[model samples]
Target: MAFREYKIGTRMFGIALGGSMMITLYMPSLTIYSVGVTETGLVKGLSYGHNSGFSYEDPFLQGKGKPLTVTIKKDPVTGADIDPVDAYVYVPGTPFPSAVRNPGILGTEVAALSADDGQVGVATSDEGAVFLVSRGDYEGETFPYIENASATRDWTAAAVLASAADTDKRHVGSGKTMFVREGCEVSYAAS
Candidate 1:
């Protein structure tokens, strides 16, 4: 019996070859395939869109203490309608505020608008602005919002609809909870 020895990470293993005139073999690394967590302790397999507005702690405005309000407009009396579904607000150095729950006053309907014909106001303690985005607008269909020193974004419409379609889904257990928690609402175009 002919024996072939291989060294893997300071350990040696032997393989027996029997009656092999010509054969091809492939050896892959023994590292476990990662599905979620990365070496840097961050979640993997997630993508984000672009930054649409003023970012917190922006280099241009350093040490300028001022609370900024971000409004998502649904209609434009003078120009064009603004879709609230295509907007996201990012507050750097702070966690994204949970979407206020209500019937229509201020909830995560994704259709809520401010008193103005086209605006959803978002109050920020820090200097930041709202980011306007659309489905599949940037590299990925996800919107990347930086908050609490971490980067997060809204899930695409496909993901949201899929989550809502599931019957056994619950509010807390549902994947679309982020949409509700983030006060995401939809806005319709005025006809």
Candidate 2:
């Protein structure tokens, strides 16, 4: 009925790839939502965060009303944010799949959209794809798509993501920076 915003807990409860990514299984039917919403951010105690400091670590990308910066992962070994993967694309939502890491499951194929508004690229990783989402709380944001060399926070459509390298063009997804968690909101994953 509603296309909720995504957060760190939004990843499905199916299989987890490495630690940063998960193969979606039970989060059925994702194309696009006609309604708008806002997802809560991760809380850190109760200092009223974000000045050292963010309200919470929101990974989803957006550019509607609020402007968000993309989160980059370090090499762990290298400790640098150089040439980051940006984002990862899953199945039906992203038109291009070969450019990113394949979940190698039912997600390998894109589902046919009925009245498609077309899909844009988002992002993910292989180790722990902790998908986060919003149940009507994350305003001015949506999923993140990393295949574009940068996050999709600019709100560009699928066409802008393409280029000379077909691979780069096809690496589309819903993740630009961030899905579901728990408590009252996180439980929505199961529902």
Off by over 4 Å in 2: 1-84, 89-152, 155-160, 169-191
What TM-score, computed on C-alpha atoms, does each candidate reach?
0.20, 0.15
State each model's C-alpha RMSD to the native: 18.4, 21.2
Candidate 1 C-alpha lDDT tens digits along 1-191:
66654456224222334213213332211122212112121111011112112345333422122111223232212233444332232333322222211113222122222212112243332433333322121233232221211112232222332332223221220222245235442121110
- Index of the highest-lDDT prediction: 1
Off by more than 4 A, model 1: 1-10, 13-71, 75-80, 95-126, 134-191
Whole-model lDDT per candidate? 0.25, 0.23
Best by TM-score: 1
lDDT for 10 in candidate 1 is 28
